[model samples]
Target: MKGFAMSTVNIYKEFTDQKVTENVKKVSVIIPNYNYSRFLNERIDSIVHQTYPVHELIILDDCSTDDSRMFIAEKIKTIKDIPIRTVFNETNSGLVFSQWQKGLKEVTGDYFWIAEADDSCDPHFLETLMKPFDDEKVVLSYCDAARIDDDNNVIRENCQDLYNMFDSRHWDKAFVTEGSEEIKKYLSVLNTILNVSGVVWKNIPGLHDIFEEAKNFKVAGDWYIYTKVLEKGSLAFSPKCLNYYRKHTDSVTSSVHCDIEYKEIVSIEEMVAQKYELDMETYRWQRIRRSYMDANVSPEVKKKKIAWVIPYPGKGSGGHRTIIQNVNALIRHGYECDIYSEDDHRTTDEQAAQKIDEFYETCAAFVYVGANPRAEYELCFVTGWQTLEMVRKIPAKQYGYFIQDYEPWFFPMGNEYLIIEDSYRRGYSPITIGRWLANKMETEFHTPAQYFDFCADTKIYHPIEEIEKEDAVCYVWQPEKPRRGSELAFRALKILKAVRPQTKIYLYGSAVDAPVPFEAEKLGIISVQECNELYNKCAAGLCMSASNPSRIPFEMMAAGLPVVELYRENNLFDLPEEGVLLAESSPESIAAALLEVLDNKEMASSMRAFGPQFMKDLPLEKGFAQFIRSVDHLVLHTEYEQPKAEQIYTRAPYKAADEFRAQALDILYTDEVSSTDAAPAVPSLPRRALRKLRRIAGRGVRMIRQRIGKQ
Candidate 1:
């Protein structure tokens, strides 16, 4: 806090743009006090202890209820070098501008500074700010200020509100611009100069008239008065934060909405536009600035865009689809969403966006080929494990993970898995798809996590009463996706076909045709409407997951198709058993669970009745609202109540059958099945488990594949 003021080193600088001149300027300092006794002594010290001395100092106490008058009298006694006066008002002036009017009557210097009693400035504030007056056109000179607390700790080094309005980065450096230019661009945009304590104004004739006219309105009088002052001459600004503006916890205008403020803001906008003859572009921006005046409405945070870094998506990629869906949701809620794609396939941004619109839902996000965007985002989301590195290179105020799955399971327990784990260790407050992924992040990685529910588009994947049910089953078998458990699901379908040979089988959700041992129809890459029809036709659908359960099962249940998934912690925390069945990881268990749903009509009827009922509460809109609330937390720089992770799936998975209980048997043994009909999924289920178990046990599964390939 000390030794960093401009006077700590040297106050003088060589000026090339403007002529450098030395002058004896008479500077008057005014401390307008009202119930700020705690800070009065320090405020007086800051003004009197300046590197450049003041010509006169006047401390005006506006009948403060606190002991400010006593303090002001005591403070005046210590100021021996400068001529100082203490004026105690008979009545408390209700407005700050009234105090400014009262103090201006006592000012005898050529330049006057209305230093608020709650704020303090550096020793070189006078020396630095007074120099700009050497140019006769400079009427008011102000330097950048640090926001400080009553305890004098710096909240922020430089006030960023100066740039937030027009994003004019003049606060980053020193400049002297025309006063009318200031009024048109900045003052019209709602007081971009911010604090008056940072300003030293030349005590020009008729300045009192500006304050008297300005004080007619409350809440925006400072802004209006600045415009009036700047109209007289040029405005000078130094970027060095030499002034400290104290913000109190109990500020009246801090969180309250005032109709006077809103109305006056609109009035000023119109007045400035017409007075300066501002072009339509500046006038349009001035109108947009009125939204910030509504305190009850959402803050400027909603105006900031959220950026996403995602892997280059393929057609029919559900992960990328979910990312785009939420991006569109945000856009609908008044946030700009820019999606950066990491595509090594040399895909153009247009091509990638076209593919997204073609395969996934239509998105309103701006799609870019690389991670770098032109503007820095307020919050950037790294959409997956693959794009974490790419998102790191982006410029953002905060970075987070848009986690859909427990991505470590997407790969084997090796290099990529370890890197994904480290990505979570980067301590991103991840916004997950469901409670299970959020719970995993909070418990395992110890990061703050937020979740939106796994909602199916009920209107699309809904019941079609015309389609009659068949003694059939469908499997989501995407071989390219490791988390889908394609091999496990494929084996389960084989056993189901073996048990009841009359059962029709179908596989979908993949574009590339691959060979399967079982008898089934491959309806490769069905549309959403076609998927709804398929879900209605089948009695059961198998959607297996080794990680967080996919939304496919939810959609199936919504369409009255009872779904079966592997019983794991990932599934147990989020998936409900009403329309979904959780089975142990084996061919026998999955086949048995599918059979259980098909065989029991009473249970199937209950699932059909409740699946959509449950989905009613978990619509895409509800999930989107929750996501928006979590993201708004980032935007407002405030944390909502951090709730403990609660488990939704309270019941354990259905018990594994007692048909195959030989713990000491070798899991590495690979048994060959001659045909789907030849292999009975009966008491020989123990032998049926051998091949899948070998795959789980590792090397033997690959060896058996090698042997089959040779044959």
Candidate 2:
């Protein structure tokens, strides 16, 4: 039989080689077995008869107590034409570590298919599963599966419920009719579900490490593995049921008979909570446990607590300036505050110390904000570089991310993604300084954010009475970054200088290497005290951005100077009508906008006057209040409890009270609840009636399966 199988394998190889190169056919199926020889032959037969021919089959058996190893060895010997390799594990090392790890190590195929010992696949499973891999973006793929009983009868068809399996915005349309809008929605939803065995990852840089990390996880190992894969690339799903998932009385999933199967189900939730740094709510804990067991917890129980921590910037950078102004305003308005930063080393800066001490009197606490090895805080408020390092270390219920600008660009690419990804994964409520930053957080990072305009000390930034409209002054500290679009401003200013020599361009910030093209005032870098003077002397400020909607427009406006704003066409925020002199990227366009503002004294005057109104309307205090409210709403409305009538009324105050009243009344009258008298009356139905109901259900299932087959 072995000799005959080898001859058959040679013939098939010859036939395949004559027709097509094996390189075009890339998938290999690996089956790892332990014991249970009863199903070994059928599992191998299923693979041999697959419509799509895979490159090879590698079977590794752990020394089984039963004859399963012998049966698999016999099957391999019989299938000589197909390249087959069999290795026997000296001892049973368990399914995940021994059999699966051995297969992972030995398999040389581009993609691997794992067919479990008891589970079998349809003839077309390999062919269908491999189709999605044609697209390079598809790093992982999985097909819908059916739950089969011991006799191979499908107890439930379409058992791969991706929506229920993963906590993602995608999955609602996973099983819609193909090419339809519903199918798109399903794909969108399925994109987020991480199914490890159902997926085939390319031999990328991090694949092995991901698998190893997953093996280390005691529970929710599959989720940990799949999520790592998803972070690297996109996922694809097949609606058709190719694999049959064995549902037995003695299966590992079946053995975990907890109220909520913590070993199996709780891992995903726990992983999600830890990843996002979310406070595990009482209802969420109960719901997770309840999925596996009929366990109950009190609704009134408080599972987690939240604290708001903020890092104070003591220096006079834009971030610190805003924080100081806001803190003072809050303190004056009777809101309790706290201050934390690197220890105040400059005792001579009397003004800074006075402000700090004044704040300290009203603040709940004040301490140096740094890596505190011994201290633990529930939350940390952070700004600038401190946010990148300190925020993650603090195990906080809520994070108040006060983003003043798109600061990530200042860091390297990988570091930028790390900061953004961490914030997004940790579920921080970001309070952004501008609309552009807010939209980027929402669209790119998929994190919820609210926009608040930067606040200035109106007393410091008041209009300069002695200043007169002469020449437009362009002041930028670091004008090298592409996003700043400073080079465009330079070109425009050069043209404007030629057209009007009297115009003086004052360049500030970092300019160590680059030479000034024009005879301009090069104040390499200025102190905070000098920034106001620059604003006071300038007739109009030059502002430009390729990506960010910068604070310069608002800053110049507050200083009673019209702004020549050169921005990208797809600006996320709407520009001010009168105060902003909008310019395109082209030098000609920038010059044109600059000339218009320069030539029209009346328009410039109106813009300068309109600037104060814009500042007044968008005060930081009002914006901060709105930010607090938005955070409150998100925390309150997050899906913790299954919405009760009272919860609905409280959470959704916009809904009419009468609507909730009617709903409450309906719930009270529903048959879902039973009285003590009704409980005694609710006896089991007669045997004949119960049998009749079961027969009807069985008939319905059969009819549905037949209909599906016909379709």
Candidate 3:
């Protein structure tokens, strides 16, 4: 079957047996009323006094508390020429489509008009709309509409002109076009048919199933039903301005929430795209343009929107936590924010939204897992190196970068590293998470950057009690990740164990499946509360990173646990004090630092006293304030390009390509993933024991070389 581009001439040719007759077509005028008593008389008069003849009229009252049922009952006494049937619902069905279904089942006419209770049509509405059905292929015919206020004064002259702004082909001219072609081009994007009162549909068996399917949707049911009915035959457009769509504060469409409506539109478009195999790029552009138009915002009062393109937040990731925090902070300050991720990590939209609600419960930022619908934000912020490439293809007024760490260091000194390094030089204003990164970007790349301090949640990770401290050492161990210096930490822990064999060892952050040379308790992938409890019990904490400092040290300090880490530039920039013992990346240096904090009680006490106070000083609010100030500076200082039609259309194919790449990668690299279900626990060794093991291994190698020389 042809999905989209069916011809009207062919529709008529196929139905040649059902020949058109000279007699006038019987019309069923369905008036579904609900509390529109003030306009009911006018609506009834408009239909009964049509210039053309009607065969039957059906009036359904959806249990309105208003006097509409009584009003309609009395008005029927005056309409003697047309056969009329009246039914008052016992209770409200809560859906307008339900009434349409009821009226359709009883109607015996060749065509049906759902004349809404609050709207009125011109005297020639039925006559003008029914003329196109002269050809048996015309299953649906609708006229252009005039928007009117509650008092019946015209608000806009022609609604079709605004509807046709994006496509400029069909509504501007009258045509009896194929149903599939009409839906593929226009109706797939948005409901071009302005009102139910303006439409006249043929009573076919296919329309019943369409109405049933439409019942699943509340806000965009009419649009869905219109698309399905059009697939049966052809659509006829009458440019005669014969219908007036009434806009009021209390109407059903006006009362529904805006997000729900947009979400429903997205759902409908996805269903249509899969069914018809339409050009996804065109559909994507249409979704965005339609949203901009549907916002109906005047140019004067519109606020700017921003989007953050980041990776999917797999379990136990500090990067994901920081991104969520930044987004929530921006949203709290009245900036509308949205998050888009190329990889969803096998998460559904509902599951992602729920997780977002759990993390930043106060904010209502949207999370899109796959292809981002047309949001048309004023600014786009790229949060990761891979996302920088995707954001380039996404349409936005201005672009910026959210730099947490130098991403090139995550890879080796090769092609991937160079590509990631080039991402920083894309001419976007950079927002850094720490002062060291800010200074590095400005000095090396000549990119003037805005920087914010890293902070921990003291409310969740605070000193519990003096009694909670135990003789246990905690380590943030992520073994598979080479950048965390897991081997260095394990060697140091081995040394610490030999010197202090009585101390208990605990590990968290991830689970381990591989064999390790030492023993420790693996409390894998824990919640914030459990993590805080573990930190409170431990006397000292170990955190190592080859590049920037990990968030684990700050969190450990918030729980009053003294931390030992590599004395890298990134760590020295933040924790160059007595609270955190610093050492070189060598196993000996790390082991000595860990032993100093673990063995000396007075030094441990001094560090513990300073830990919580230092973390308490650098709260999330301080960082958020800096971030907002930088965003405001850029938004006010930078000039954004005006939106153009060609830009939006040209950039749509990138998302499709990105989706293909993500799927191929998922198939190829199945093992190198950190999904929540498959994450492994990481193990660690003690401090002084690491030195003994190294000496033993060195002696064994020397003995083997001596034996080879004798041979």
Candidate 4:
């Protein structure tokens, strides 16, 4: 069916001062179509069956050469009741320009929607999309989109984690609240702007001007438009998949040229940067340049254009070692390299200064590795253990959060909000270490990120001693917290101890004086010099995480030791199947996994052989290179990186509370009827007046009935 048309009268103007106006409730859906005749009908049908009735569908057909026009003409005859207006373009016009100029001109309702012809939405899409606009500060609203294949089967899910959208603390708090006020509060803190199809934008001041300026841009138009809108007001987001974004072979998104798109995107982004008064153009350019490097370009050209930056060398934990190895690998390749750390103080008595000095000397470039108030580093590289508070103090062009674990969990409630606020405010771009974290960052924070898995130095972590067939060794870093699966590990060890008393269990990391619950040896924290020795002698490793992926699995694999892993459902990252045992976080499951790994010699040997190869596959050098490349691309593609709103009012946490409340009241009272109403109805008197009138009429009727009885 053809989409709805704009109302004849100026609905917005008529209801501008109508406290409780029906216009506020009405939605104008603008579906722009080119030539996807096959999917256009289904999309229109979905819109027709919407649960919310106060809506008009506006369709713009951009001079399609196919049967799209015929399809629309035939469908419009059948659906006569639904207000559908069809606009045919005389000549071919690009998607962004056509929508910016003609689409805005045709829009007559309170908000405008862009439902592309190939995409479809759930019946409740309008209801959910409109909820955010209840607060006036929420100029734009978006919902998660479900990814569907050609057959309409759900090929993938696009559920957003709240952590990625707001501060970690705010997300945690938002999920725990029972009131709508809490949701509104969190939305104010993390002003996410994107998901255009899932969004409904209020026709506010400067919106038209912003669209007109961006009308001529072919690629990155949506990005530019959203960035501009964010400058004017806050954004609200729904995690629910109200819209379906179809992936087809002939989609414009898939066919666009990288260089051409990059150039246009860069130009627009630079314009935005200047307009917004942001000072992050250099970081933006670097990100864009990396994208060009990854595109179909020559290797020599890429090497010359995009240089790699690595944090200086240091004797760190397994995680830090991986980082150093990765940097070394990139340097080995034909890429320009620079390293930054502290000055040469390795021989000094102070441990921190000595470490910094050693780190600096080993790399190409090195500065002090602390809170640098004056450092002009383009990007601040942060390790998992580093404090986000300290990272915020640094004046870097961009911040790269290299998380090895769910490190934010360590902070007190509301602290993560501060950290995320600082990063975004400073125009930093996040780069996570794994798929799980990357997905979390993208969906929840509304920040784009790349996943660079931990790469191991296979040269250091390898099988040096012969495997003892009779003995199975279990390594425990700590046997305390349940989240670490320590309780389960202890239970499994007890069972294994009873069954195979000779099996040795080695505990590492923390020092414990408690009596042994089972036949296990406790090895307190050891020097780095002795870690490799212990790993080489071990037959297998025990790896576990309550809600996140751990690095121990990869480390064990590198040492040719099969790993018995406790699987948690929330962990969405990928793991190597071979040499890794997946078990539920239970005593029985843990025991079973341990038994399988210890008893099966052939399986153990297979895992031992597979470990080295897996380590080789995820070399630190390759992952680091990929990371550098990703950062480069992001810089190039982004036009202007706007500071996150959270930082603007972070010092006064409740600074926007009054403003938010005021805006909410305006949205609620602006319409002629309750914004929740589905259709037009007769006006009703105040509840108090209606109740009094009904009582008075009942009394008069009662008195007349009594007189009749007396007669």
Top candidate on lDDT is: 1
lDDT of each: 0.76, 0.54, 0.72, 0.55
| Best-first order by lDDT | 1, 3, 4, 2
Residue 316, candidate 4: Cα error in Å is 6.3
- Write one digit per residue (lDDT tens) for candidate 1, span 320-430: 878887887776555667788896767898887777778787676767888657567888998888897888878889987898888888787899999989899886778
Tens digits of per-residue lDDT, candidate 4, 249-271, equal 55553323555554554464345
**lDDT, residue 373, candidate 1:** 76
CA deviation > 4 Å runs, candidate 2 = 1-316, 327-369, 373-378, 382-386, 407-415, 418-422, 479-488, 509-514, 523-533, 569-574, 586-588, 627-711
- Summarize candidate 2's per-residue lDDT along 1-711 as a digit string, tens digits: 012222111112211222223325566677777775777777787777666666778887777899887677667777855688787878777646445567777778787777777776666666666676677766666776666667776666664353554354343333212222222222212223332334445555666677777676555555555655555566666766556666786766333334223443434444443344322122232233333332332212212222233444332244455554454443232222344454335433334335544533222223334434223333345555555565566565456676765665655689664775565546666766666677677777887676665444465565778755456576574554556666656655655565566877787755454644344677765664466677777777877755555655676777777887655532436456567766545554566567677778898889889887777765555656554444444445433211111100111101112322223223222234322222311123344443343344334334523433443
Task: Compute each candidate's TM-score over C-alphas.
Answer: 0.54, 0.40, 0.52, 0.40
lDDT of 1 at 508: 93
Order of all candidates by TM-score, from best down to worst? 1, 3, 4, 2
Single out the weakest 10-residue window by summed lDDT for candidate 1.
660-669
364-462 per-residue lDDT for model 3 (tens digits): 466677546457777789888768667876677788889877789989899989988887787888887776777778778988788777788888989
Whole-model lDDT, candidate 3? 0.72
Which of candidates 2 and 3 reaches a greater lDDT?
3
